[model samples]
Target: MKVNKDLTATASANLILDELYTNTGSSSFNLEHDFFYGGAELEIWTMANQAGILLTEDTDYTLSDIDDTLTNQASRNVYKAVTIDNVTYQSDDIYFSYQACADFVDADDRYMVTREDGQYWDLNSSGGFDLVVSDDITFKDQYLASAIPLSESGTTGLEGF
Candidate 1:
């Protein structure tokens, strides 16, 4: 299955999840497809962007749900400003580079569980990856909205997607 990263992160993530579920018989764990694409991936993008890190196609990082992790060892530059719960924390404080931090946030399994209404948190404290909340689920909504114009009424009109 091919996925376009340019599309909102959730759609892209769903494509990945679909491919994985088809090939590996994996379950989405009650999380929406948008959780991976928009929530996890976008968190990486936002954190990287906030650190003044530009994710170039080759120089940046890539996300994989097969093993479920985000990695960018290209430059290994550490970040200093990372805000969590409105409190800023430094990557140096945790001795993790910005990319590593993003990877941890995106890939860690504990963060995937539903904690409350619209909230998912890290239940593991072993690695100290810091607590993060999932955000930006609109990508899936936008994809669904985009489908309205193409849907025919009966046959699955999810052709171009």
Candidate 2:
């Protein structure tokens, strides 16, 4: 009879190695935290509110849930986009930056994004939107380096001395 054993420890180590070297092809143990920063692609629906354009939960632009924040180490820097008459335009894209929130706790769930002209808008039930956000984000890892690598020289055999 054969018994199966879990390789949790080995798997954990491999997971760490893959993440560190997935982009650079080499692991860097010197990172203060195991937060590997990477770029992620995202698409959010938008709508024109009373003030200006804002993100909507669904393509209908009638949803109340507004996903205004990209929860990362830093604020999610987003590049905006819009669709009109079944045609997309990139030049008319909007840029929204993270600003102060009424409550930091609420900010964790969803925060406000201000326009480049320093204006914050409210969401309204208007046309549907197609907003694309591509930004770099860093995530934290639980593991830490416990040991350093040691060097060893090859052994030469001298028999019958």
Candidate 3:
């Protein structure tokens, strides 16, 4: 199996849970995808222009979640942002960044599982590297499809790296 490692900081600013017309006054929202696991600090701008006023945890919003299990993670993806008094966001006006994972694949077509010590957080913390892969996984001995063509620099000059 191949894992697609993506540390992309996709700044999603699509919907506004609160507005003058709709007036949902929503207190929370979810990222575009689940299984976010963990990531960098969250980022939120009140204006489309990204004015100097950047929102933060506790002061402007609150974020929480415990990605301890596969089934428990999706619910943890919910992000709760406090309302800014009368400053209702009537347009595209919220953004954030975090580390995420779509962890079914691995880099070298090698198979991996989150079943280390029989826990989900093992993949992120603990001895994740020590996880067990069943014998079903077949190794691809050759990393390169063809022989490497050296510049002959190694023999020509020992100084060449």
Candidate number with greatest TM-score: 3
Q: Each model's C-alpha lDDT?
A: 0.26, 0.22, 0.35
RMSD of each: 17.7, 23.2, 17.1
lDDT by residue (106-159, candidate 2, tens digit) is 222221323334433222222111221211111121121111223243222211
Report how far off residue 151 is in candidate 3 (Å): 65
Tell me the tens digit of each residue's lDDT in model 1 across 1-161: 11222222223223331111111111112122212232233332223223433233222222333222221321222221222221122121211111112322243233343433655443222333134333222122232212222234322222123
Which residue pairs in candidate 1 collide? 9-37, 10-37, 10-38
Select the stronger candidate by TM-score from 1 and 2. Answer: 1
Evaluate residue 78 in candidate 2 and report its C-alpha lDDT on the 0 to 100 scale: 22
Where model 2 places Cα greater than 4 Å from the true spot, the runs are 1-51, 60-92, 96-143, 150-161
Instruction: List candidate 3 stretches off by more than 4 Å.
Output: 1-24, 37-40, 48-50, 70-92, 103-161
Candidate 1 Cα deviation (angstroms), residue 139: 25
lDDT of 3 at 43: 52
Local distance difference test, candidate 2: 0.22
Leading candidate by lDDT: 3
The alpha-carbon deviation from the true structure for residue 55 of candidate 2, after best TM-score superposition, in angstroms, is 2.8
What is the TM-score (0 to 1) of candidate 2?
0.17
